[model samples]
Target: MSRVIHVFRSPDRFIAGTVGQPGDRTFYLQAIHEKRVVSVMLEKQQVQVLADRVGAMLDEVRKRFGAPIPPPADEFTDTDPLVSPVEPEFRVGTMGLGWDAEAGSVVVELLALTEGEVDESVVLGDAEEGPDALRVFLVPERAREFVARAHSIVSAGRPTCPLCGEPLDPEGHLCIRLNGYRRGVHIDPHEAPDSDDDE
Candidate 1:
């Protein structure tokens, strides 16, 4: 079945945002152009990978085409939060990214579950066909904005234990680096423990 595609060219607003706090957060990518708005839900890893790729894409664009990159907007974070994101158009099943030669912009395509291919005998869990995709085009500066805000939101999650390089909860963590001996002990990731030299 042919999928419906919402294409936003040089979108006025394109950003990645989260709905909840830290550990329980839900990630979303929103694209807005005047009255038309398209929102989609995706995983945290997807958000992180997208940001990294977008940043790398910019560097490649510069070296390859000498594309002029606009100065990133003064504001890194969204001035206005996710708009009417309660009902996402779809939960993204797959995503495609590329540069548009004609438009001279980066295009992000988000796909949702494909309806036509569903079959009774085909085993529900595994399917060959992917989801329908929406294409969003953004200028260099706007893409940079997306990467910056995405990084900010993704990194704002739980603090990491410096010793074992693992996430630490608000209450603290039972650091695995110390092994089973420190099972009950909570290590505060943010605080620096002092050392005593005196014998």
Candidate 2:
């Protein structure tokens, strides 16, 4: 089947959002242009990396190509939740980012997941045989906003364990430092542990 490419050149809204509670949340990258809405599912780590790379790419563009990249705003205006019906067209497998010098825009390409390994050449390229892709082009300011919102969404998840740097569950956290004995214990890293170190 021919691949479907959902291209949003000047999207009305493009943002990363999640559904459900913290630990059980589902991440989605949604792009909207007029009435058309394209939502793609991806992992939290992917969202982080995308935001980080986009931010870095903007900086690089400014340095190398002399692009007029804008700094992140004091506050992101689009703090609203994701659009209704939260349906995902596909789960993103491989993502591509590039700076369009002519347009002075950052291009983000999210390719759908496949059963086997994906060809690198298909990324950011016009490959007829590749998987379906969702492509969005954003100005420097919009890109910065996206990065900011993405970081906020990621950090909003479960708080991390100060000791092991892992997420702490509501019921309890099984910290590796405690050797699995203290299943439901919440210890402050600043406070000293009990004298029973022999456990």
Candidate 3:
């Protein structure tokens, strides 16, 4: 089948957001242009990496190409939640980022997951055959805004465990450092530990 590329050259809004609680959240990257909205699902790590890369790309563009990137702002202006419905067209498998020298814009491409291996060319190129993709181009200032919002969304997840550096669950957390003991749950010193039974 032919690839479906949703291109938002001058998006009205583009942001990263999540649904559900901290422990079980679903991360998404959404782009909007007029009434058109394109949402793609991805892991939290993907969001973090994307944000980091975009920031770095902006800096590199400024240094190498003399692009005028805006200074980092104290806070992000677009802190709103994801667009309504929150329906994701596809789960992102591979992502691509590039700086468009002519346009002085950051180009972000999110390709849909596929059963087979993906063609790298499809990432930043307009290949006739490839997985679906959502492409958004943002100017330096708007790119900075996106990076800020993405960082905030990623850090809004559950607090990490001090010992293991893993996310702590509200119900409980099993800390490997404590030899599989549940963290944050009180254990009486006098009480005997439960033993495992074998069939």
Candidate 4:
């Protein structure tokens, strides 16, 4: 059977959010318009990059097509499990962003990961049979809101150690900058973990 593509045109909602706890989170991109809903899985880094790129895209659009109305408050869904029951449309392999000059929308194209080689059938226009893909078109202002919310979601994750740049649990981390010494860990006289850094 031919693969399906989910498209949300001028979605009423488009946002990036996470599911699960800070250290064990799964990032998701979701859109809703009319009766359609689309959700795709992505990496945390992808969320960050998507947000950053959206900001940049808006800037370019402004310079070229005059400024759009300022976006409303950067608000994402506060409810835990951004998308409940957690079913993903597809695991995103590549996400592409572009502007529709005629329609004045930011087009987000997500390509799914194929099992093997790419579908070369997508040469001129249509695809006869292809892997899953999702597309969402957001107005400039809505795009801005999505970007802001995305940043917030990414930052709400586990804190990073200032020294070694690794995620820090509430108990602290073993910072390589501290020569493999775990910050705030008691070095008991009885059983201290042997470390080459503890010279």
Candidate 5:
């Protein structure tokens, strides 16, 4: 699961982004009008939940802003990360309307990444169920045409990793056939201890 991060201009105006990179997962957001920016670093699943909520808000936003607005230019790289490399569309989530009709401007809520801890190279969760994960309300949709396009644009022309099957990290990687932990190889649990203690 990915994360959902929010950027709110007002109680009614808001947006969200999933938080994750090749290995350095973190949410980056900036609200130009409000003169505010926020970054949330959290685990994968928490972010996914938030995304679901935001998806629900899309309809409301559509009514106000008129059809889900195209993702802002600065939001993504020139080449989508999910395509060419990911092959299958890796749609993380959606952006839609919120049910705050009282304020009247279709509320834009994002299925976003929750707040977490971040470092220079990578963003990580405290534990599987720790507070590090940013909970999103919206879930990833099968058809994420918009997100696919955005990832490509933001990537600035980079390839995805062959091993982990994600976008490559900034430093690049070594391509030697690694032993002990091959993708399809299986070792007995009891035998694993002997190998570790030997070290």
Candidate 6:
């Protein structure tokens, strides 16, 4: 069964589509405005998966930045309302979908970000539960910002890991701490399991 998902959208503009199978990593993203059809295949096979992640990020943004407009009555069932294409305070823009049998490659096009534009290439993550061919990835601007800030923090040569209060070597640190209960691979894999067992 094909599942329809609202990938990214706001009070003014939105993007939504349906995913049918888990074969190709790509699908097609259709944008609607004033009841006109604007179709674009987001060449990447894992678009739906990426869209799911982006949707989650947007939810987080809405929670931290402020709040998302309450879902209108019958928001799910109601017909797509007339909306402007203006970028909203929300952190998502320019949605894409793709499939492999039809499209050859998964392509990502950045539309906007928290500050301005995002030009980094989207990287597909390792496959998970679903079909290997139906992978997903995204290059949200906020994520890039997180990376840039992290890099800045690392290069800034401050003291202690921002996440963990561990001291660093003169050559710099490699994130050996796990503030969010999630440690980097740099930590001893054997130690993680042993530590977890203790907990």
Q: Rate the local accuracy (lDDT) of all candidates.
A: 0.77, 0.91, 0.90, 0.77, 0.35, 0.34
lDDT of 1 by residue, 69-176 (tens): 754443584657888745688887666678887888888877775546534332212234445456888888889889889888788888888898788888768888
Q: Between the candidate structures 1 and 6, which one is better when assessed by lDDT?
A: 1
> Can you write out model 5's per-residue Cα lDDT over 1-199, one digit (the tens) per residue?
3333333424211132333444554433212224333333233443344444443455445656575433323232322122111111112233334343344333333232225433312222222332222222221221132244334333533476666445555785553444334457778887875445544
Q: Highest lDDT among the candidates is held by which one?
A: 2
| Candidate 3 per-residue lDDT over residues 84-191, each given as its tens digit | 899999999999999887787999999999999997888888999999999999998998999999998998899999998999988988888999755487778779
Runs in model 6 deviating more than 4 A are: 1-26, 43-45, 69-75, 78-199
Q: How does residue 52 of candidate 4 score in lDDT?
A: 88
Cα lDDT tens digits, model 6, 85-161, are 42222223443333222222222333322354332233122222211111222233322332233233223333555
| Backbone clash tally (model 2) | 0
lDDT of 6 at 3: 18
Model 2 pairs in collision: none
Residue pairs clashing, model 1: 112-131
Give the runs in model 1 whose Cα sits over 4 Å from its true position.
Answer: 70-77, 113-130, 183-199
lDDT per residue for candidate 4 within 123-161, as digits (tens), equals 211475767778888887788788878888899999998
RMSD, every candidate, angstroms: 8.0, 6.3, 7.9, 8.0, 16.3, 19.9
**Global local distance difference test of model 6:** 0.34
Off by over 4 Å in 5: 1-26, 32-56, 59-97, 105-158, 162-164, 169-199
User: Against the correct fold, how does model 6 do in TM-score?
Assistant: 0.27
* Best of the two (1, 2) by TM-score: 2
lDDT for model 2, on a 0 to 1 scale? 0.91
Q: After superposition, how far is residue 103 of candidate 3 from its true place, in Å?
A: 0.7
Off by over 4 Å in 3: 181-199
Alpha carbon lDDT at 43, candidate 6? 36
